[model samples]
Target: MAALISTTDTEAQSSGDPSSKRGGWITFPFLMATLLGLSITSFGWVMNLIVFLIEEYNIKNIAAAQISNIVNGCFSMLPVVTAILADSFFGNIPVISASAFISFLGIFLLTLITSFDYLRPKPCETGSILCQSPSKLQLGILYAALALVTTGTAGTRVTLASAGANQYEKPKDKGSFFNWYFLTVNTGAIISATAIVYTQDNASWKLGFGICAAANLISFFVFISGKRYYKHDKPMKSPFTSLVRVVVAATVKRKAVISSKEEDYHHNELIEEAMPSKSFRFLNRAALKVEGDLKLSGDDSFNNIWRLCSVQEVEDFKAVLRLIPLWLAIMLVSTPIVVQASMMILQGLVTDRGLGPHFKVPAGSLQVITIISACIVIIINNWLVYPMYQKLTNKPLTPLQKVGIGQVFTILSMAISAVVESKRLKTVGNEHPMSVLWLFPPLVIVGIGEAFQLPANTELFYGEFPESLRNTATSLTSVVIGISFYLSTALIDVIQRTTAWLPDDINHGRVDNVYWVLVIGGVLNLGYFLVCCWLYKYRNLKNDDQEQDP
Candidate 1:
């Protein structure tokens, strides 16, 4: 580790020389450009997807939302697999570049679907009693496009963050890069949600999808062009494999007596000597250097499986075990957020979207309110709220505390959503359309909750997890989102089949009841979260102070 740090410092010093080939800020633009182009391409289709399904394909609104949820879930989840591949096999640049090409192909195929007639179902005649559903062939083509796009977006999204952070050795520069990365992401989202949605709604689907395809194509090349300037990390075997190995080895040697002496464990020469934590004592058997477990006198002749492991390996596995409950609790927190996002689009469809006499807002674009609010809140919280709190209290709010505050806001948002939805239902009678602005308060509240929870949740994982599992740690947020989305899909399906609350036509159904369910669920989940927070101890409490660096 010292040698690695020395090399990085040397590279940093040499970066000032005009002739140096590596290590500087020159790669930032390339990453930003790649991110911007990809975000535009991904969000262009995703944000407006429900509208497209309802308008062009004539699918039921509820079904369309479910499909969107599934796609979003896939989009979120695929990053886990990709991040693992980057960290354990292929590394970041290759995975990102390959994903970019896949994305381009996906969007390009979508453009083709829009430009051609046979690729999609025939347009339903106005006020037709029986609209023609898309054929199996058409559905197959569409799903293929969605799969490629989801996989592509997932691969590139988080991997780029890792790649960018690798360029800088200092924590401060890395933190600053992350801030700008998120800002670029939001910027791309706003543009795609507004401009691209408007183009698809008012102009032509072909043109809009074409623009997305073109952007993706450009992004692929942009990333490849910067390959020479970027710093690259070599892929190594995943720590997850070692964790699993420890479990298997410990179980095989269950009858073996554990040892109290430090010398009884196989300590890696490179790592400093330390006793294993007593919390998960059973796993300590995995590291016990019993007779025949090692060949200390020989070269490359030691038990590799079902026998022994290094002391560090056992503790790493235990750290992961400790985090599982907290991870599961947070999954519940995200489920309602996913459910609300899916439902909000449907609500916007029914609400009066007119801004004035001449302008009307697109239903799909309503999410921009949430996006804009979250960005603003993130800025304000970091720049004003946190500092002020620290000044007043003489100590900063811990990550867990921040997340707990987020839980409160989440509960409030759900309650607010339920009330607003009830009001909208009441006003929908007598041909009265509730103003779309009614959706803003809940969305803004949820956004504030995100600002609090997301950073804390991310920091907790990154700070607490084993160093070898850093890639996996950062990707955990994506995993939660993915699982929550799938859970939300299942929840919506159960609601549709088991209750009258979520019919195809929400006007005839009790949509407000669903929000009430979320409110109750949010409260329960918040309770679960608080309990987890109480039980959880930070593995690196001092390291967390560095996490606050700007």
Candidate 2:
């Protein structure tokens, strides 16, 4: 991955220069600050979106959750498109800058909507007979704001990570950056989930959204201020096109005889002595020398890319294909967590959330437990657990091992949630409702799972993917999360329509059954993940280990 750094860094280092104007630790503060601001702004609204819809729009509990899931999906999915654009056309800085401004615009619009009575439905008590839904014009304005916010958030999310990682030339430095990056993100989330949410609940929604808008504008400027100091990767032609070419070339030359000789296969100067791997022999045909395949003058380039591809290109496509099963398995694991998040909010609403005589926890702020737990787990793993494990085993845990451990935690969290919800149900109408403290254990467990899964998955993808797809690689986890959120929405809808397990009023529904179902799904996902881990081979394990070694 360090090899992906620009040649300027290498040249400066070789010249024994202590100061490189391009990129180094100097860019750290600016990038971290930018991330912190963005995280705070984005989470302010995202964490409380379901409640906002239910309270402000007169949306039913189930419908509000569904809308939240779709919003979450957009938050994750649009990044892949932005990442592709960054890697192929605009580069990261430009895309991030544009997106940040867009976010500001959206949040500002949200603030306006909150401040004005005309922009939302009339406020009505939950389950009221005369609840009024928003008119089409009002809905249109709200959707347009959400669209802008979602697009901006998705565009900046993964692209910023890739850009930050690009600034460092060492793997250890890159790893440290990611660690700090997530910490900063969680810290921002903590602020948003707690302080901002409290303000929204107790003070004013307009003020909370105003703060978010201000943060977005400030972060955009902070990012722009570092423009000259950052190391920028120039955009190249779309690498996705090359992957398609490999597939097309292989299909075109399907009947070509497999070659034993080295010269018969196409090789660029970088892999001149490399032989095609036997793992995916059929793909090797794409790089085989065949009739009418023309070579350009004095270079390894091919004139007809559709008919002939380099061996490296074929291998890159194979790497992507090999990742599918593991990706799907992880997506399944994440789906349950997504469902649990929305469920937690609904559960908190009907439970006792009092912390003391004068204070009550905002339902949306319950997610802070997860973020706080993840932060603590990350700190411990970085400073204690990972070091001890590496010393005892003579090698650190692989990303796959971390993911497996996370899957177990995920299952445990689901089971715990089911038990807690069951207990809550028993006391639903009693003089004393179930205390929100019971929600802590499951939330913390899921946070620990995330600490293991999210970073490990990001590291795995970034390390193994082809260099050309580095930005896209970073966004792969986002793609999984996006799809999982969508799946969670679909699953919730099915459950609502198919059974009495998830009625519009969760108080009347068996919410524990939903958690139990997630537990079963999580166990199945874990099984699938383990199988994929057993069968899959790392393309760059040795290099990755050396780079990751502390």
Candidate 3:
């Protein structure tokens, strides 16, 4: 019955009528996503670079960095709300469109504030037109704009991709489309980060930011034009519906998980060895009872509830609950990768050797390498690595396994930076330009990690999620990335303030201690990645168990 339902849902979507614009609607949303990425992420990199130019600000450690954390954290937490809305009222099209517009507005406002300062002038002021310092008004605008953009990225970007994935015909095609989708996304981002960074570096900030805004608007236009082709799945509307859906879907996933576990139990795999702590287990056990009670007592007008649900429902509930911690762990590893554009990149600017005399590299541009490298690596991995691995091993890696591979590289990427830091420190005060080329190796490593993890993450999210909770799962994955962004910024703040040995010169952008700070983050990321690998290796959720029949 479950298999039937899953197949039916897939067919309902892919069985495109010849009279309808099957492919047109999908391209529209995807184009919107691309535009959103160009504009919003462009601003994101700009804001991050703004904080890193501490020399321009003159104040020591302006807690300005913390703003990234606050905004990112808030965005991460708010997705639950957006997810609910997407399920109920907004649907994918509305949510994506609305979020893009909101984010665009936020960025426009941010640009206005950044260009006009009341208190400080070098960074904000333009000759005669005085820019205000961090006034209450300007600060408010900054954060408010940040919140809007974050919402746009989290709410719209994540949801739209998941929604678009549904537009494809077959399950296998969906899997392939997502892979291509993610690849194109990074490719677009790579162009934005690098090209836009170059513009911001060589051209005026306004021009760079303006270009991004234009791109965003263009993206929205494309998405709107071909929306007719999409399969319009009615999103769950009521909060109660959303809540019930999450519960019901999670329960079914749990049953699949248990089935997978039973299979693993027979095979003597490392499934049992992969448990979190005793506390997590106890919580899971406790939650089982709560779910069982809820399933027994809650409104049950559906036929499935009337039949076999009494027994299988509880186990399915348990399985979905079981995966959250694991998700958290995997996200921990990816967070650093996500933050490379902001925290780590900034750290490189002040800490790594400058590109030339008084000519440090721009923080915003550093993100370019990661994106570019990711694109290059993705193409290679799909065409070369996966094929080579399959030929060599007779069995290719799965998504989680691929994610684990990415994590390993994420760790190594940081280690590469740490070594570079050691090099920069030795050459300090010499006035000789440190090769920005040194930054590329670490950046490339990060790219390798991203190519592996991001595609894997999207697949893991959709595959593991129950059909009803697909949007929620996508939202959850974005939140995980969001949380990591906040954590990375927070850590940067702590290190910048707490380090007793940071020379006054470097603190003010002379010594470039940013590299060292990132090195530490890399080490921390590595440790967490190891744990993610272990947990992912242990997780057991089988296709036959979770999948419903069409």
TM-score of each: 0.93, 0.92, 0.71
Give the TM-score (vs. native) of candidate 2: 0.92
Models ranked on TM-score: 1, 2, 3
Worst 10 residues of 2 by lDDT: 541-550
State model 1's lDDT. Answer: 0.87
TM-score of 1: 0.93
What lDDT does candidate 3 reach at residue 162?
Answer: 63
Runs with alpha carbons beyond 4 Å of true place in candidate 1 = 1-20, 295-306, 543-550
Q: Give the better candidate number (2 or 3) by lDDT.
A: 2
Quick one: ranking by lDDT, best first?
2, 1, 3
- lDDT against the true structure, per candidate, is 0.87, 0.89, 0.57
**Candidate 2 lDDT by residue in tens digits, 1-550:** 3344445566766686656557889889989989999999999999999999988898999999999999999998999999889988999999999999999889999999999999998899666667999999999999999999889988899888889998999999998998788778888999999999999988889999999999999999999987767877779899799899998999999999999888998887776547788878999999999997775767575558888888899899899988888899989999999999999999999999998999999999999999889888987998999999999979888888888888899999999999999999899789989999999999999999999998899888988898888768878898999999999999999999999999877888999999999988888778778878878888888745543321
lDDT of 3 by residue, 1-550 (tens): 6456445545656775343334433464555456446444544444444443343343233344455555656666676677778777868778777876776776676556546545233454445334334456544665576666667655655566666766766778666766666665655666665666666666655566666667666666666654555556577645344334435533453543332232221111332322223332322221232232333336563223311222222333444665676577676775566445444544555554365566656665666677778878888998999999989977666776777678778877766666775676676666664666777888888888888987778667766654556666666666677778677666565655776433333423422344455456556665665554454422234543222211
Per-residue CA lDDT of candidate 1, range 1-550, in tens? Answer: 6456446555765675333445458889999999999999999999999889888788889999999999999999899899999999999989999999999989999899999898888888887757889989989999999998988999998899999988887899998899889998999999999999989988999999999999999989999987767777779988688888899878877888887888878888999968887888999988987776755545567666667888888988888998999899888889999999989999999899889997888888988888898888888998999999999977788877888888789889989999999898888676768999999999999998988988888988898899989878998998899999999999999999999998877878888899889889888887887777777777777655533322
